[model samples]
Target: MKLATLTLAATLVTGAAFAAEIAPSDVQFDEYGAVDQSLTGTPGNPEEGEKIMTNRGLGNCVACHEVSALDYAAFQGNVGPSLDGVADRWNEAELRGILVNAKKTYDGTVMPSYYRVDGFVRPGNAYTGKAADDSFGPLLTAQQVEDVVAFLGTLEYEE
Candidate 1:
């Protein structure tokens, strides 16, 4: 029992240390609310972005927005607009800004800022019900935001 407890403690400590190492996002929005610069200086993988968007524990974007490409997800939400031909409507920079922080683009939007860290009213650690500490980072990592942007870019109108 002692060994198990020690192992769990060690794992938690390691995880916390890793989480603390995540640097805050440096993305800057343009006057048009577009993030023309890449947050991580790395191009995102659309495949990984798709996984993040669909996963309930992760992005769970379907909870608020409907994506016809993600038809496999039941009960895609309607709170947000249907993401059909989103790429045709917005460019990559604009998509990046929206994924990083939608309110910057559209005021009064209910969309959560995936890459912002400082402005939340009562931020908490993931599912812990504990007030977030310095170790608490943005809702999504910089790369994760890029990935989602890449994924959204793929949602072209399937005509």
Candidate 2:
């Protein structure tokens, strides 16, 4: 009985620790729509970021942008500009802002705001706005957004 109780306690503590890691969804943008703050107050892992950016069930950045560093990915779309040398074009905060909400940076952009929750039309429901059963939330976690930013920062011109 003591062992079971100890295990349960450990699980709860660990779960809480992980839950606290997620950054706040209320993001603040600059005049240029750049997020100048770190979402997690810690540097993200570039390797993990790369995985999240390419994963179809996750960031799925390849669906609209082509990343030369991710040439292994198939059927990369061109709707957005190439991210080959994005690191040279934008700073870390700018990259973070773009990921958090591209529409804030470039109006009329089809990019989905990955971390925004408020100001959404008929939020807290499915995308079709017909199903109230599905609870809509930030597409990616705070840590995931930081991770993608770290990865994008590495996409400098290779030439």
Candidate 3:
């Protein structure tokens, strides 16, 4: 009986410590996880961001969501969450997590990683064994990711 009680106490204490390690707000995650950094500075231009959204060789954001206002093409995908009011829902760091690698934020996600390393399988061919490009290739450059983040910042809802 004493051993069982001690084990329970240890479990409870460990759980509490783990909980304390998390940030107070739901918006903050560690450098390796989702976080909030929207209030830091000016974001990217929506117009230039629009280009990334529609670009098939770069961001290809339309392949997973319907940013109707941004995507004029009819073949936009519907696999991921719609990006209509994402800016209102998430801050820059949060968006960065989803953009950089949605699976890091939510496991079992079909979204591919844009900036993360070692999370994907090795590719075969000319790009052979390169971490940057999966079977599809690198989604966007770091600058392009920043531009997309800036563009997403403009998607706030009118209150």
Candidate 4:
């Protein structure tokens, strides 16, 4: 029994450390809200991004926007503009900013920050302490942000 308790305690500590390492603690940007300095060598994958876009627990982007690449989604939100030609409108860095936090580009946008971890006035209990759910932890990892950006980068108004 004591050994089991010790093992569990060790596991919890290790888990917390891992989470702390992955959660982004700060938001960064360059002029035009385009450069996502956070994105490093972790290459984005459009295929994986499509899955995240429709995932309610992940990006859940379909909950608030329409994307041409995500036609199979049963319900695409209309609150935001269509992403048919998003790439044409914005470049890679711009899309990164939008995906990371649209507020950087559009001040009053309802889009939540996928990779921002600070300045939340009053977060919920579920997001109060845990590294995976904290006011100083981003909603999505850096890789996830890059993946989504890569997918959006492919969209363009085919005229």
Candidate 5:
């Protein structure tokens, strides 16, 4: 009787442990019933996308990456991963997450938060608080971000 009880208890504990290890599926629907999936189905124009990619006022992707064999633009840093085949490695949502707020997923990251709307302290003028505001504040607008995401979709590896 003691042996049977111990075996049953052990089995129950093992099963519970296995159940605890299970994780939720990646894709999830929001409160508005919109299916949150990566930017897989969107079509993009490489030329227009290239403009955004290089534009310092917009995507500014070239600031940290060497994309395309274009003209001589200076100050391209190789600090981050080379975006040669970013589309092959990450889906749209993942890219969006990186663009939106890298710090949420990775703490102590040098990457600036782009899409964060709340909890941001407003800056004072030169007399009161002379320090410059977050100069790296979002280079691209929301629509521009969507456009960039569309463009990044095209950078797939030839597999």
Candidate 6:
């Protein structure tokens, strides 16, 4: 009985320690899954997107996917496919959906949701946004996601 009680207590403590909550207002997507709607009407700035991807504290996309353009990016993650020619493979809508939540299209994928504000494990400390007690918020704002997508579009297969 004592062991069981100790185990349960440990579980609760661990869960709370990792349970970094998102801002109550941060829940942007009413739809928990694939976002079909184009969040941004205006085209995003590819240059800005590139910066976010490179920023370790922000998107830090290079941590998971390889991008040749970011030649100086260090410790590129090898889990996801390379982003060399992603534009050829997916359109803007498709890209947007993936950016919002890749799990909607490809379930069981390791890719984290860029715009999603829900369903996170160890979201880490609240990095940005206005929230109480430093609770976390969306990894990237809607505009940021669009910008990253724009930059990704610049990557195309060379003949």
lDDT of each: 0.81, 0.83, 0.66, 0.76, 0.57, 0.73
Number of the predicted model whose TM-score against the real structure is largest: 2
RMSD of each: 11.8, 8.0, 13.4, 11.1, 14.8, 18.1
Q: Model 6 Cα displacement at 154 (Å)?
A: 0.6
lDDT of 5 by residue, 1-159 (tens): 999999999878755544431111232334332234432223444567677878787667778886554346567768766677788877766666666556555666776655544344456442332222434334444445556666777787666
Which one wins on lDDT?
2
Candidate 5 vs candidate 6: the TM-score winner is 6
How many Å off is the CA of 87 in candidate 3?
0.8
Lowest lDDT 10-residue stretch of candidate 5: 20-29
lDDT of 3 at 78: 93
Which of 1 and 5 is the better model by TM-score? 1
**Number of clashing residue pairs in every model?**
0, 0, 1, 2, 1, 0
List runs of model 1 lying over 4 Å from the truth.
1-25, 123-133
Which of candidates 1 and 3 reaches a greater TM-score? 1
Alpha carbon deviation, residue 8, candidate 5 (Å): 58
Ten-residue region with minimum lDDT total, candidate 1: 123-132
Candidate 5 Cα errors over 4 Å, as ranges: 1-46, 69-75, 120-138
Q: Where does candidate 4 stray beyond 4 Å? A: 1-23, 36-38, 123-136
Global Cα lDDT for candidate 5: 0.57
Question: Can you write out model 6's per-residue Cα lDDT over 101-123, one digit (the tens) per residue?
Answer: 78877889989877766455554
Q: List the residue pairs that clash in candidate 5.
A: 38-93
Worst 10 residues of 3 by lDDT: 19-28
Instruction: State every prediction's TM-score relative to the real structure.
Output: 0.77, 0.77, 0.64, 0.74, 0.56, 0.68
